[model samples]
Target chain A: MIEARGLTKRYGGKVAVDNLSFTVRPGVVTGFLGPNGAGKSTTMRMILGLDRPTRGTVLVDGRRYRDLASPARHVGALLESRAIHTGRSAQDHLLALAHTHGIPRRRVDEVIDLVGLRDVARKRAGGFSLGMGQRLGIASAMLGDPGTLVLDEPVNGLDPEGVRWIRDLLRGLAAEGRTILLSSHLMSEMAMTATNLIVVGRGRLIQETSVEEFVRGASGNRVHVRSPQAGELAELAAREGATVTYSAALAGASSAAAASTFEGAPGSEADAIEVAGLPSERIGELARAYGIALYELTPRLASLEEAFMDITRDAVEFNTAAPATSEGTR
Target chain B: MNETHDRQSRDRAPAASALPTPAAAASSRQPGTATLERGASARSRRGSAAARAGDAPSGAIAGDVTQARVMRSEWTKLRSLRSTQWTMGLAVLLLIGLALPLCVSASENWTVADVQAGSQDPVYQSLAGLLLAQVAVGVLGVLTMTGEYATGMIRATLGLVPRRLPVLWAKAAVLAGVTFVAMLVASLVSFLIGQAILGSHDVGVSLSSDGAARAILGAAFYLTAIALLGLTLGALIRHTAGAVTALLGAVLGLPLIFSMFGERLESAQRYLPALLGNAISSTSPARLTDLVSPGRAFVMLCLYIAVLGAASAYVLTRRDV
Candidate 1:
């Protein structure tokens, strides 16, 4: 269990991590979501006791990380970047860390194999690819086999296979009752992997809730009503609390302008009218009462990407939208 | 955070740490209860126990990193890097490689008058290589401490051992050991090689020659002192180029500047770094002298090392890593 209360870090005149508090509980995979430079890395550094907090404190397993009898045994954190010496072979790096606590050499090989770097375990880490570096970092974190695991952007620069491997490994660890807290700005990835979400924007906690709840909450009230009675159905949907905006394709929507078809399935488009503070069930009830046998009754939800973008729209310190080019590797 | 989850985690780690079989050991003791009392870092009320509470989690049986472990880690870090070896090799090559030939070439043109009057000490004359080689040793010393900061490897070091003092001490101890051994071998070999070439003028190698052994041994000590100075500068500057440059300025630049000004001002020459370290062989008519004894020079050299060393440790321990 990792609990941080009012952890703050300031570098000279600029604040890196402002008063932030949250607990990563056991038996679940909690995703730490934020845009780039939103203080995710700084928070992780303080969590590992690498950087000192300007105020308050962080507790890992009910004690400061440095105070732990064996910090590696209780918590295993993989920071956003790799920390192993490049000159050393991957195996040697893991072996040396294991040796510090007198952990057996067998565990080192286990982690190396677990991360699928068995082919290159004996090779120098300097020669490894960026994906391989992340793998080795993950391997090192697992070397101790602790109850709590912290991985920051573990999927960055990974191959699809490597990304899947990490997702599976983290899920397995969480299944085994480990407290798994992984950070990433990849909403699509976290949408599939995380059981719970902790969203931070501008170094402050924005929201902490279950994944399903977050999706549901971000979905809000936007829904679609497809009926032969387009005008009457639109009126019924509107009375049930949804705007009747016109679209150029699919089901026709009525407004001050002439009839135009709506595009796609009503649920996925970003421009779809948001029906806030209403349930999907209410839309269904209104559609049935209007004798409009719903051809499509879908609630438009902000996608994980959209919800994340919405939350970080103002908080992003660096780039906001994904760069025009493809995301490198994973 | 990962360190917390690591096998040596702060909470359950001590019991698991240093134990070959954590499972068997933890079975004998009641879990969480003992860890709660001694494992957690709690704020206790009042004096003694509070003081003990400040150190409550410190005395655990496991994760006990001894001084030996620290020294060993430092040695491994120092030796494992290619830069350390490269620096040592440069020192040997500069001192032994260039200086031996230079001394031999100088001897070819030597006159009896030149030998007797140009310089009082011929052996010390041949040992000028030390002046150049000390820079390489200084680089090696800087690399020992400052390289960690450059590579972000210092974070790993501090992670393994949070208290900054032990980390600094370990680096010093390892550098001292390596520098001592390297200097011992380098100085002896350099002396032997120079003696071989200086035989043309009958100006070299009289082991029976008074001050010869001390000169050779003192040269080694001089190099070692230089290495310590390097380590001290590294701790202070925390940058390889910066530390090496500062040390080179003090040992080399200051010497030239002092010698130049001393050509005019009276006693400034005696205070030059080259003069101070070279004072061991500075005796003119006598094999050793009372006015500027080797012992007193050794003492001064030692004082230079001590002041830098104490200041290094003081700054390192008092500040965060």
Candidate 2:
């Protein structure tokens, strides 16, 4: 387990990580999420004691990282993929680290095979591709089989299969009671892999919540309903404790799935009202109670991507407008 | 915040499958607990049991990062690099190769007038290649630390042993040991071969001759000290080109710049590493008149190593990687 209390890092006048305090407990994958300039990487470094905190302390298993007898066996971190001598072979690089703490030579070969780098174990690290370099880094982190694993962008340069492989590896390790903290900007990947999320924006904590709550809390539950008596249905839904907003041609203007779902319906061109804080089934039941003809009632559950965007909207460091293009440009 | 607490509590529930396997956990013993050579660093700690708390986690027995293990790791690192072999080979070659031509030319030009007039010190001729060979050994020393920073391997290295200073210490120890052994052999071979050629003219100093053995051993110490200085500069600079340049300037440039001012800076010239090196290998009293004795020069070199070595360690612990 890793606990950081009031961890702060500042370079010159610019703060990288500001008063960040969090606990990474074993048995779950904690996703560290942030925008490009956020302090996820800096926080990880501080936890590993690579970069000293400007103020505050980080502990691995209730002690400073430097105080640990064998830091690698308590906390194994993959800070950068290419953090190996390019001129040395993969086996030699791992062996060099393994030699520290007197870890046996067999364990070196074991981690090499564990990361699926056996084929290229003897090849120079400089020649390894990005995926191979990442594998080597993972092997290095797992060399000591520490209780805590901190990885920064483990899937940055991975293929689909490699990404899936890493996801499974992280889950399996977490299932085995390891504290796995990984950072990534990919919302979909985190949604699939992370159990809990520690979201940050511009070096400050935005929210720390489970993946399920993060999505459910950010975007309110909204339901879209179409009816032949659109005006009356809207009034009834509004009166029944649901905020309703009417839309025309929303079927074509919104998602394509929403448009296709109501195609060729009896009230396909009828007016529709978007109801918030109400389930689709309740809307359907209300229409039935009022004896109103309902064409469609679709509940729009917000995706994790939308939730991330909503929470980080104000925290984004670089905001850009859409570039203007001349009409004649192909 | 309440939800976060709730989620954290839920996460705390024991994960049966996630727990470390009994076998793998059992292998996590304190690093040197299995070995008898517990290393000087282990005993230096306040209490081994208290430090071992972080290493032992009930079923898990993590290894301890003893200084001995770090030294072994440093040896592995230094030996595994292809550049180590190339540069060390170049140093050995320069030491012996340049010594042969210098001895042969000195012997051909040797006359009673040159020897009686004390124009050329035979030991100096035999070890003249040290000036050129130092560059090779010094660059290797610089690369030992800068290569890690250049490749970003220092993060992984420091992460493994976060005390950070031990890494620097182990590096210095390894470089000193390697350079001493290798350069000693090189110095011996160069001296013997150069003496064999000079022996034909009866101008060669035997191993038993006054100051001859000291000069040869002193040259070895001088080169080893140069390598140590390289390691220190590498740590201080943390950049390959900058550290190498700084090391070169201290060893060669400072002495040349000091000598160019002639008598004005004569008092300070003897303290420079290169001038001290010159004093270490020169056996003639005439040459010693302008500089301190070899013993004083050895002490001066030690002072340089201690001061720079401590400064490097200080910056290592205080600075961010």
Candidate 3:
């Protein structure tokens, strides 16, 4: 378990991680979510005691990281893939780290094999691709088989198969009752792997919630209904305390093209109404009672990505005024 | 790309199967306890004998970050790098190789005017290679610490040993120990070979002669101190080119620049590293009134190391990785 209280880090005058407080419990993967420059990496560094906090403190397993008896035995961290010396071979790098805690040479070999780096373990890390470097970093983290794993952007450069492998590996480690703190900007990935999330924006805590609640709360329950009588159904749903909006094509046809093209396009297109603040069941019941023939009724649950975008929209640091393109006009 | 993917997938097949067995075994063993801790304790209970025999189960041995372990780790780190080997090899070569020509020339040019002016110290002449060798050893020391910073390896290192100070101390200890042993051997060999060449002209100093042994040992000590200074500067500056430049400026530049002052800064010149090194490695006692004694020069060099070491320790612990 890790607990950080009022953790603040300021580099010169610019605050990197502002007064942030959170708890990461054992037996589950806690995703640390933030945008670029939102201080996720800095927070992880502070937790591992690599960077000193400007104020407050962070404790790993109820003790400061530096105070832990065997720090690697308690917490294993992969701060970055390029943390290894480029001139040194992967095996020698792990061996040197293992030697620090008297971890045996066999354990180093085991981690090397576990990470599927046995083939290139003796090669210089300078020659490694980003994925291989990431694997080596994970191998070093697993050398001690610690109870807690702190991985930042573990799946950054991974292929689909490698991404799945990491997800499974993190889940398996969590199943063994280990606390896993994973940081990433990929919300869909977090939705699949993380059960709880601690999201930050501009170095401050925006939300600490479960994956299910965060998604459900950010986007209210919405139902979509397609019918010949979308106009009448929209009014009935609004009277029942539901906010309703017609689909763009239907709204356009009803406003300007209703009299001119209504008879021409009759039965050719189905008018759809999007109902919010009401469940699909309630909308179906209301539609049936009103005698409005509903051609289709479907519940639209917002994806985690949409929810993340909605909540962090104001928190994004680099807001582009227009879509960026590579072309430059003279 | 497709072929590499196929190869990587084939490589990952066995790894995927191999990973879950340990997790399952760990969960079955105690559920929440760290698997490695249990394995380490079991291995410890099984005794170091089995561990030493290399037949203990594939598990981590119970250990914490200690000074000795960090020193061993630093030793492994130093020895495993190609740069360490190259730099140290260059140092030893310069220590011995450059002395040969200087000794040959000195023996050939030995004149009564040199003896009359009392400026010719055969011991110091044979050890002339130290002037170049010290730079090699000093660069090695700077690279030892700065390399970690240059490669972003300092984060991994500090993460492993969060106490921080042990790493600096260990690097210093390892560099000092390796340099002392290597340079001592090189110094001894160079002195012997140079003395052999000098003996051709009947101007050689024996090991039994006054200050001869001190000069030989002092050369090694001075180089070792130079290595430590380089390491300290590396820690303070944390950039290879910058730290190396600073080290060169202190060891070589200060003495030259001070000599140009000529009598006005003569007292200050005696304390320069190069002058101190010359004083420590010279055979004769008090050749000049302003020159420090070999013993005092040794102590002064150590004082420089101590002050820089303290500064490095402070910055190391207090700074972000």
Q: Quote each prediction's TM-score.
A: 0.77, 0.84, 0.85
Highest-TM-score candidate: 3
Docking class of 2: acceptable
C-alpha RMSD values across all candidates? 9.1, 9.4, 8.7
Which candidate has the highest DockQ of all?
3
- Report the Cα lDDT for residue B104, model 2: 95
**In candidate 3, what are the lDDT values of residues A1-330, reduced to their tens digit?**
889999999887667788999999766788998777788999999998989999999988778998976788778888854789999999999999999999888778878877778899999999998888888998888876776799999988888767766777776666545678999877778987887899887788999998777887665557888887777777778898988876556445554555333324335456777898887888889878978788899887778788788788776723233212201110
Model 3, range B267-295, lDDT digits (tens) per residue?
Answer: 88898888888988887543745579999
Stretches of model 2 off by over 4 angstroms after superposition: A226-230, A235-273, A276-298, A317-330, B1-61, B112-119
Docking tier of model 1: it is: incorrect
Between candidates 1 and 3, the lDDT winner: 3
lDDT of 1 at B314: 84
lDDT of 1 by residue, A71-141 (tens): 66666767765676777678777766665555567677667766668899878787999899988887667
**iRMSD of all candidate structures:** 9.4, 11.9, 9.2
**Candidate 3 chain B — worst ten consecutive residues by lDDT sum?**
B5-14
Native contacts kept, each candidate: 0.09, 0.52, 0.54
lDDT per model vs. reference:
0.67, 0.79, 0.80
What DockQ was computed for model 3?
0.31
